[model samples]
Target: MESVALNPATLSGPVWVVAPHPDDEALGCGALLAALVAQGTEVWALLLTDGGFSHPGSRTYPRVRLAALRLEEWRRGLQVLGISPERSAALGLPDGALAAVPPEQVTAAVRRAFQLAPPALVLLPWQRDPHPDHRAAWEPVRAAWNTPVLGYSVWLTGRGAAADWPVAAEAQVLTFDVTPHRRTKAAAIAAHRSQLGLIQDDPSGFTLSAEMVDRALTGPELYFRPYGQSVD
Candidate 1:
């Protein structure tokens, strides 16, 4: 499968990166985001969920407290990527249950977020990224902004089924080498402490495995551009 190497400089300004949870952006598109910011692209982040569901079983951090902490972590990570807090918006939707939300409602929130600085390009989770929230996020974002989008992979590499990957006819494959911004990407990923095992009370709470983190930090992030869309 031949893929074009992504050059951040070619992208237009006011690019928006949408994440279903706090850490999805860092895990999926951190390197590319760093690259875009370094090249002086105007970047905005939109978080779809409260991110409190990860530590559901933790007594030390209740849902509200966990959500607040995760929001802070998200902003901190964005800061590392050169995005100011003023450029980010969190929808506060339910984590792990995006599919349950009304489609119009979700669409409305996403549209609202994009109004301030309409996106020239959008980076969103792959439609078949293997996480329910990731998959559910696809439509509303598309509905909100009918512009060029690069679908970044989060769980696709690790947990996706064979059919989940984009076929030749479905998308134009693109890859961005993370080598130059590896350190920046890693720092952004590291800012999410709760996802990195900071919450010890929830026995079944979500924590990014070392393997997942390593895979994310590895070079060449995958992006799928749907057919008929031009990123430029």
Candidate 2:
């Protein structure tokens, strides 16, 4: 059998979430993290790659500068979620160039992250995401599989086919109720002012007004458990 990176674990376990971008953490697993925090379970947020080129046509904010700007966005978002710097890591792979990065390079990053956290449960964006970067975030994490991985949703943007997403084979847990956490997640996403243009190019300023609706109407939170008897 081809070796997978993550291992399987119980549903309720110390968790680590891997995100392709800054806001995806909230869009994909905000509630899950909030729920875990409420339960006093340790949680870590792993940002797989830097998101520097979100607004593809923006001449003012080129790669290097954009990376720095996005890092600030990440820090602000983490602060809103109360995720400590000690518990989170940002892997600065080239922005908009996930496809260009070698698989080994990405896997090495995952290995280093796992060595630091060794989480019993992992959260990730499913494979179905249209963005190459979102999908790119999955590879190394999947290759480092000594533990169980729980795939989360973001690219579905809450409006696509809910089944057979490009998620990894190990993904078993699917979907979790959002409830009150929905608003909290939206508030956190609003922290990323630089990247809002990617969403709609509104330039109307960063606020919860736009993203808040996406969280409630389109999707709540989704997860996939990739291990044990969980698979159907």
Candidate 3:
């Protein structure tokens, strides 16, 4: 696992960020997105799921309302990262059931995205992430496009040791020094109010645990190159 700083200049083409859920993009690549946008790189975030099931047991907020709230939260959060609503989209796929979406549908969506602008890099959740939805998000995209990818981690960081990391033996780890954009990243993350203990009444409501947020904000953001070419 080799570490290196992100050189924004190297990212000269359009970039696509595939988030399994709304907040994953911000938590995993908030600083990266801010840095890329500063370099004038064309960037887009495609949220694969509606994030409606974060608090699945809640009777007060039905799935439809919850999905709508999450979408709005995502828009506001992206704006903080310097991406306009026009540059981002939600596939409207059901939350927590990405594996059930027709294989062809996922492929077609990705293919269509390429038509708008072929990405020089596609950022996705690491394949070995503990969250089922995170891992499921990768399969279709993996099968759909041969485009270069750098899988960012959200759930894997909890392992807390290099030896325990769930990655291919040959995978190259790239670390981006996001110190300059740390505050921006935090602000972007905070924009997702619904995910950060904002809903207090429901015991089942989702909350990004403070420990995870601390780890994310502590240092350089890491990305995994599972195979083939390196983005560096």
Candidate 4:
């Protein structure tokens, strides 16, 4: 995959963002959402999972409780990005198990979101994001819709890329100058406090270090168009 440059500000109209978990949207495209909303672009978010599995072994926070909490956190996070609750859909799929869900169900959810707000472009998790849930969500949508897709990366660059990444010679990397919306992006990410070390009981629970948050804040929000498709 070769890399080409793109500007992210031009995205307009009804936009749908598909996130694997609660904070994936904040981590992946908070700035872009903020930029879009600021420009009066109507945007919708589709959260595929509850993100409850982060604290897998905690007796203090059961799966049900965690799921609810994560959903609330996700709502708050999207609010920070300026999306109203009515515009977002929490599909309630099991955390960490999207890959196992029925393909029809997943496509139904995608279709439902489209009915809610037909997307000019759909923002998806990068196909090879190194997260099973992210990959799971991407596959069904890729197969179901012919809409233009802009794949955002949360774990791919963090894990280091292999030769297959960026999608061969046709990849175009879209970059957005998020300086105006950086503060909101950080707040949206921080809204997921549980994922950022607030869960003290579960030693094994996932926690993003301050360093990681800082790193995400420093760069422009980016996405990859595998086939060099226009996001407009």
* Higher-ranked by TM-score: 1 or 2: 1
Better candidate by TM-score, 3 or 4? 4
Q: 104-131 in candidate 1: lDDT tens per residue?
A: 9999999999999999999999999999
- As a whole number from 0 to 100, the lDDT of residue 196 in candidate 1 is 92
- Looking at model 1, residue 191 earns an lDDT score of 98
User: Which parts of model 4 have CA positions greater than 4 angstroms off?
Assistant: 1-5
Q: Give candidates' CA RMSD values in order.
A: 0.8, 5.9, 2.0, 1.7
Model 3, 1-232: lDDT tens digits are 5566667677656888888899898889888899999988999888888899888777767789889999999989999999999888678888989888887898788777666667778999887777778877777887667778888888787854455364556577878876889999999889888888766667967789999888788857888776668664
On a 0 to 100 scale, what is the lDDT of residue 170 in model 2?
Answer: 46
Arrange candidates by TM-score, highest first: which order? 1, 4, 3, 2
lDDT of 2 by residue, 64-111 (tens): 777788787887777676677788888888767887899888888878
Error of 3 at 60 (Å): 2.6
Could you estimate the TM-score for every candidate? 0.98, 0.79, 0.92, 0.93
Give me the runs in candidate 1 sitting further than 4 Å from their true place. none
The Cα local distance difference test for each model comes to 0.93, 0.67, 0.82, 0.83
Q: Model 4, 155-218: lDDT tens per residue?
A: 7667646842564565677676667788999999999988987788899889987776876787
lDDT of 2 at 121: 69
